[model samples]
Target: MSKMFWLSCCVVLATCFFQMPTISAGSRVHRVRRIVGGAPAQVPPADDPKVYLRFAGKAAQIKGVLDQPHYVFRGIRYGLKPSGKDRFQRPRQYFLEGDIDATLYPPPCLQTIPGDGRVIGSEDCLFLNVFTPDLPDGTEGLPVVIWIHGGGFRYGSASQYGVRNLVGKQLVIVPIQYRLGTLGFLSTGTPELPGNAALWDMALAVQWVRNYIGYFGGNPHRIVVMGQGSGASSALMVALSNIAKGSISAVVAMSGTAISNWAVENAPMITAREIAEYHGCPTTSAMILLKCLQNVNAEIIAEGDTILERTRLTNRGFVTGLNGMLGAAPNAEGRFDGRSLPAAIEQPPMDDMTQGNIPKIPILTGITRDETKRAVESQYQSEIIEKLKGIPNFMDQVLIKNLQNCTHINDAAKNGTKQSGGYFNLLNPLQFRNYLKIARNNFIQGLSKIAEATNDALFNLPAFLTADLWSKKGVESYLYRFDHISQNKNGFGHLFLRGLPIIGNNTAELNDTVSHGDDLAFIFEARNLDGSAMDPPPVLSEEDLKVCDEYTRIIAEFARTGKITIDKKPVEKFSGSNFIQIAKKPKANNNFRFCEMALWAGLADRLKSSTCQFLNALDTTVKSAENLFFDTVAPAQKNIGQGLADTQKAIGNTAQKINPLNLFNRKPATPKTKTN
Candidate 1:
């Protein structure tokens, strides 16, 4: 080694250097006495492997393990840490230096586990993990697939996903982390605290990829920005963003559309105030409150971020309420509003539904068949049906009100199904009365009724509308409805509310099955943080695995080429029913597509044409296209000022004592849905 290397090693290995007191930085160094019988001093194995790449006139040496056919780099910094002074602010592009020892994955962004408000993860967490077949070089590159994980915008991490399968030799996979919950999306519509920081963070990541991906064996020009669920929404938003214009070549949005009513927040300022004061940061001034939040610990911030959903108010004993029901998520930064603060707008609006700012790109979007089954709490099934029968004022408060709440994240179909107090509407020849009657009777009957309605209103309608919008514009768009119901022990298509699979008999009942996020198993090999596969590893039946293989083939192909297909046929047969129905092997129902189209979209023709004709008479006056609910579901307070004031009052007027410990640390009831 050179004299400079000796000096640097001496400084880094300070304790070892101290033993040799005579050693000098610029002098010839002599070895200290070694152990008895030592033939020669053996150098320690390099702590980690290193691979270097130069991009944008800068160089980085990444150290990742040999993950077989792929070179895997974990916890690669995609942007500067959005922590301390930068908390809640738009993400700043992370500058680079030195050997990027990206061997171990970084901690997840700070977020509370759902059900209980216990926090996990760190704030200094803006990293992307890359899995590539080719190492960083300056020659030709492979097509890139950048992944964004989904978690209702409140919580999720890059580490939660497995990218090995996605990073086939033909594709380079990069999964990135953005700020989540209060840390990421908190905003007051002020320039200092504009919302949609996560979106901006995603935009920043896209910029990073465009500038540096080529060095990592990824073609910067052939980047496919893909996201699932909230990530899907974010991906769409990124594509629509002014900053990311000409950055992304294509998109894959699974189970989400930015146009859906639940996608964007109308009142993040109200949520911010509630969060700040509830977490003990009492200040009317937005700047002071923000400063207080910056000083707060990430754990407290996580608890505070989730407090809104947990804290319930007695709204006349029917159902408890919170000031803000919607979790801390992406909100309008007032970029388009002419009168709003101009500085709050970080980037000009690009993918807005109403603004018609959608990007011109090849898009693939799809949804699971029973999305609302996940949206509706499984435990509430009995109570839902019970409340619909013979109970006074039950129809309004418990049923319709809860249905309204579901509209925020689910569907507004409850508005059509649920009946008001007066019997007059029932007596009259109302066009929608039969539809309402069928819905109410179904609600009275069992789970499937409300479940189906909510599914259509929330997941299906939004997905269909997104595809329709692109199709109407003559843009290349592929649509799919994932109907594969897994009956195996670890049903590939069925997971409980906590995301653990519903095994054995639970998987057998494929009636109202195939919950949300279940398709993930097909895309990746699920593994734990310790770099080992999960204990009781999530397995697919041979049947389900076959389906997984097919979907995987199609998705991987889509990532490779721009086209989406299964076998040799196009994924969607829009000429007939417009969507490809992906069920298990031996698709039994021939008219399943036409029948489902009628039920979910309320298509009169499909309803009339299919075997289920009794439901055809029920009217659907409001078109799914017309009922875009994302920006529409504001709860009373129209003005931001009023909402904030009311939110403050709600925070101040607390009758019950809050034991943050009891509320936060109390172990949740059995895991119902996936945690991430």
Candidate 2:
């Protein structure tokens, strides 16, 4: 009798929950508990005090909705609209007017979807969304996380991510939108229009949070700026900037950094002028160019962004001729842009990082085991193989193009190389040829190998470089590699299974590798651009949710405290050999692609001299011999060590003489005495 009575009560409650009516926007209803991963929930009445707040010397009412686990305030304008005369200008802080509605998701900054090329979004798009677990009353609040979305700095929005998972962890999450493409990053190197408006927008948003997040139960002092992909790059860039210097507490840069080869735009003026000319804008004077560009249609300028990455730029020591990778990226700014203040990114990101000019704060950065596996398979596999077949001298032509961008560090003035550009020329012709052979052979065998090479040069190496550089400066650097792939179709790799012909959205069904953006599925309950639930839903299996739980727990712990730990053990500090391998069983690992990275590092130093051409083949051949001799013969010599040690030194010195990367042996070229 007792068991039946309890069972009847449980059934009655479940029926009531399922039958609850959704409140319309205009109509008012009593507060009803909403289910997670369902339709948008309604907010409290206008008279409720939680819907109101005072910020920037004015009273404002937010139309936030109850989304089960948390309260989310969407499309709150943080900066003035960058339209009309304000186009291409630095962002100015926006204040709320009387009874302003902050409900709908703001339009994304103008950009064309990568594969479709259909331009969407608006010019008046400088808004941020805030998600809070619960509103506190006059006490020190929760640690804040300002999430910057990644779409190569062009296509992502703040609205795409539903942060119920994060907010449920007793933290506040804010996702802010910035300008993209030509409008966000076109510079003429003049006073009238200094570029990096997008960076400025980011800085201003950070400042906005520093000032106003307290009103929404967020601790301003404990702000963690986190991002993925180019968003990750932007997060690091902003954290290192003077504009948002003291505002950020910690930085979580995932899979991208400011030091990534593709992050900084080497020549902004060239791209700026091309964009100006494309829109029929006057390019004679800075003032005329700014005026004309400001007046041009925003969509026309967005379309012109394709011009930003037409030529195949050097990545470390190679060029893939892969289009759509970088488009109008961030660049260094002048100290005096006629704005009475320093530029946000005062110098190249690599320069600032190497010189230890960044903030004294903890940083968490890492990448997937295969960051661009699907990207290579989807976008450039066919093109690369076909080009190799068609052009007999294609590889040679690519080597020459890479040589032009080379920086001879020994004596830049004498070698005709720019010393200050931060281009570490990491491969000579022979070294690059050998490297190309890997890709060529992989093309014949399997494309995954080519993808591995690309990942090493692009994401993996950059991540390690960031960790190594920061660790050298005595900063607490935490690094990880997300090796866990979901059991279901919840990973970002699933997006590539069927879509338009683009790297991120490809029509290919090659789904073996854990591709780029895969970790994001476990981080946020993602939605479409229109703020609707994703079709077919990103349903997580039991195993998949375990990974998600672990991912969130690590991030949440880091946000609250400065340290990163997994399963109650502190993650190892990166000294080139320490990092967390995030898998079903998370553990510390030693070194990531050490030999390949050493090869690149050696190539950078050895290629400094003009004599690299002749020594390339000799260097490659002797290096292999040195490895064989040392690995096989050196161990045997240990038993009879004293006898062969002298002979071994002689052979090693001989090998060093021919090694192309051996810079110490090459004596300075002294001026020859003239004979009378």
The best candidate by TM-score is 2
What TM-score would candidate 1 get against the native?
Answer: 0.72
lDDT by residue for model 2 (1-676), tens: 6999999999999999999766553343434334578777676454233456676688876667656657778888989989879998898888765675666788888877666667788988899998887665545778999999877666778888878888878899999999988788877666667788999999988888888788777899999999987789899999888888788999999878887654676666655655666666655666777887777778767766744433322221113232123456688885676668689788877677666687888888999887767666656666545434433333333322232232111122232322111233444434444444443333443355456655766677678767876776677888889988665432464332122112445534554456677788778887876467888777777877788877888889888887877667777677764788887777788756654544444433434444344334326454333111011223332544342333322211111122212312233233222211
Worst 10 residues of 2 by lDDT: 625-634
What residue runs in model 2 are displaced by over 4 Å at the alpha carbon?
Answer: 1-51, 306-326, 390-429, 432-442, 488-504, 603-676
CA lDDT for candidate 1: 0.58
* Residue 222 in model 2: lDDT: 97
Cα deviation at 615, candidate 2, in Å, is 17
Kindly list the per-residue Cα lDDT of model 1 for residues 406-450, writing each as its tens digit.
233223232232111111011111322233344334453335545
- The collision pairs in model 2 are none
Model 1 stretches astray by more than 4 angstroms: 1-50, 114-117, 136-139, 312-325, 336-351, 374-377, 390-444, 489-512, 529-532, 571-577, 584-676
TM-score of the candidate numbered 2? Answer: 0.76
